[model samples]
Target: MSMTVNPASVVDEGEFTVRRTIRIDAPLEKVWAAVTQPELISRWFGITRFTGASGAARVGALGTITWPEREPVPVRVEAVDAPHRVSYRWCNPCLGEPVPTEIDEAHSTVFTFTLEPVTDGTQLTVVETGFETTSDPAADLESHRGGWDGELDKLVALLESGS
Candidate 1:
């Protein structure tokens, strides 16, 4: 049987945030690499290109995420804690408009991934915030809510398959 994981999202204080937790049957380091590394990221998420000095998801790093037929979504790394956590601010480009090369706070959101070691593997929680600043907060939140549901499941499958 397939696993079932549900994410929670809320709109409060003018900001929209969605939080999802998944228990991956993989080691913490492996899961961390899958999320932060560009090569591994392409397997489940979009094609990620980090334009930072180290090409790792470090603070101040600028990058773009391009899907099959979509514009390259711009992103800037905001925080990092090695195998534990990483955060970035990116525009909600899933709305189908031209992807901005730079992020504007009023139109961007922050996505944070936090990991914890569990008995079986790792418990990964992703929290995306800062939607209130966007022009279409509710629509953006809804778009990402659906996006994460599929993307996170792909991540889980990727790790579980040992790819």
Candidate 2:
């Protein structure tokens, strides 16, 4: 079955926020697994091709994101509250070949993913900031918008599947 997250469910909005809240038919830990675990992450989002032998997740925990032509984006855990919240910054994040835009001029951006519990399930919010673009604004926005939408959809599917 296809997963769905209604835009109306968005509780708050920020100028820099990408996805406000994604309610999943799963528990906080389940959602967290989908977000953190390398194997589960790959199963859901197709982002992690493989993982280090360390095999653990903790604050300041480092990992790689599998994107071809792009180096594995090293990630450092900024904040962790168990199955509640997970905030991290992507190290040397390749924001898709700087589009000659002001935002692209910036060295990198900060990506934070938060999780909250709701009556239905877990409410997930992913906020990516520091995208201050001038030229090629459309390209930058379009790429991010499409990418997040697709990724969020995948999260829903993965969570619902009980995988």
Candidate 3:
């Protein structure tokens, strides 16, 4: 005998917004610490160092970003409902040409991570949205997709290693 439960019948539509879920073998608090702390930023984000005085586990905190490819970009704290949600916009000079003053679509694009409590540990979902591209978009998402995946893996490794 065979029976099937249609996935749509059971899953919440909002839960389906996530395209990826990474399970790390760490508690929710531990995971949140790594994601929010400025001093610990480089351990996962590939940044050389992070500087944000108010960003040390606080809402409405901002950070200065530094990657190998370009200069440090300013990131304002959009929202920081911590141990569960952290939302912020990130734009590098490398993301594209600076948006014209009247058309600043380039700035609002963001990386938002939502964490949910789970049985073993935590389920971290990182969503990079506002990519709304008009052309030559294949490489951008391709780059970001793998980049986020790898970063997630690194985050898991860092947390699991008890660092």
Reference-based lDDT, each prediction? 0.81, 0.60, 0.60
Worst 10 residues of 2 by lDDT: 98-107
- Clash list (residue pairs), candidate 1: none
Model 2 alpha-carbon drift over 4 Å, by segment? 8-15, 49-56, 68-71, 91-106, 133-138
By lDDT, the candidates rank as 1, 2, 3
What TM-score fits each model?
0.89, 0.72, 0.72
Candidate 1 error regions (>4 Å):
1-15, 52-55
Please provide, for model 1 over 56-75, each residue's C-alpha lDDT reduced to its tens digit, 9 standing for 90 to 100.
57788888888887888888
For model 2, how big is the CA root-mean-square deviation?
A: 4.9
Tens digits of per-residue lDDT for model 2 on 1-163? 6566545222112353344566898888788877767777766554553234344356766566655465555555667777777765553433654322122224444556788888968888887654453234444445566667777887788778776
Best by TM-score: 1
Q: Per-residue lDDT tens digits of candidate 3, residues 1-163?
A: 1121111111123322224577777799888888877666678885633344644545445456666665566565567886799876655333665522222345444667789988877887777665554233444455566666666777777787778
In model 3, the runs with Cα more than 4 Å from the true position are: 1-18, 48-52, 55-60, 93-107, 133-136
